[model samples]
Target: MEPESYYFLEHRQDLWTFIRRNPEWYRYLTRDTERINEIDQLAKQYFGKTIPQRLEKAQHNIQLVRMLIDMAGAFRD
Candidate 1:
């Protein structure tokens, strides 16, 4: 394994898990060791780690909670 690949295993365990669970990325990372510098950005793109994605997820969770609370209120006597 390349020293750059080891960076994923040793420095970024989260990214290591992501790659392990994803065969496509695992192959890409291992094969294109030169692109290791871009791994952080690529992982962010693949994993939807951007701000908009996070905001959207938060909004969806809030909406689900609101709906659950409303449903519970409707069931009250």
Candidate 2:
């Protein structure tokens, strides 16, 4: 696989593991409309595509980043 694809898959797996480990924060992180919109915009800029086509991917990345941020907080000493 290409380096980009390899890292993408690895990051996705890590996100899934983090989600499983912290189910309680999932709903809250997913429901944040403001952050979601910001992420959507960034995805559009990064991918150079319009909505609906890129909506799902954007949302997924948003959730992953949010979860990672929360996980960092929880793990920080």
Candidate 3:
């Protein structure tokens, strides 16, 4: 196989803009999703569920981070 090039002119700018605007997404991509696995392990060790009972069994932990992510995705679409 050969290397790919970013020479698709129509998509070049859109790709650059999307990448430049989403540094956090890049950060998250760099982060190990194993972090979720770690959280899972903790939940299993402490209790017997994948999530906290107080948070999940009760009201959802609706926080700013998730809300912002959803809102941004909505706007993008």
Candidate 4:
């Protein structure tokens, strides 16, 4: 086994989870353990764990509320 693969099996549960969740990156990540952090970022992005995604979701919710309020106002009028 490659040293990196062994290291992954022995010491990196987070990376293992990342791999399990995103199998497409398995080969690339296993071949280059140096990219583990990059994979971590990808996982955050994929699962909407990043600030930008969260903010976007929040903004969308705000817009939805504003639209609903406007519709309610129109009904009141």
Q: Give all TM-scores, in the order shown.
A: 0.62, 0.33, 0.21, 0.61
When summed lDDT is taken over every stretch of 10 residues in candidate 3, the lowest stretch is 1-10
lDDT of each: 0.76, 0.55, 0.45, 0.76
Pairs of residues clashing in candidate 3? none
Angstrom error of the Cα, residue 13, model 2: value is 30
**What is the per-residue lDDT of model 4 for residues 48-68, given as tens digits with 9 covering 90 to 100?**
879999999999999999999
Angstrom error of the Cα, residue 1, model 4: value is 8.3
TM-score pick, better of 1 and 4: 1
Candidate 4: the clashing residue pairs are none
Cα miss at 40, model 4 (Å)?
Answer: 0.9
Which residue runs does candidate 4 get wrong by more than 4 Å?
Answer: 1-18
lDDT of 2 by residue, 41-70 (tens): 444554556667578779989999999999
Cα lDDT of model 4 overall?
0.76
lDDT of 1 by residue, 1-77 (tens): 57757755678876776677765766776677766667667677778897888999999999999999999999994
> Any runs in candidate 2 off by more than 4 Å, and if so which?
1-50
- Name the runs in model 3 displaced over 4 angstroms: 1-13, 32-77
For residues 1-77, what per-residue lDDT tens digits would candidate 3 score against the true structure? 01122232124454334435644433432454333334334435445344556566544446666788999999999
Q: Sorted by lDDT, highest first, which candidate order results?
A: 4, 1, 2, 3
lDDT of 2: 0.55
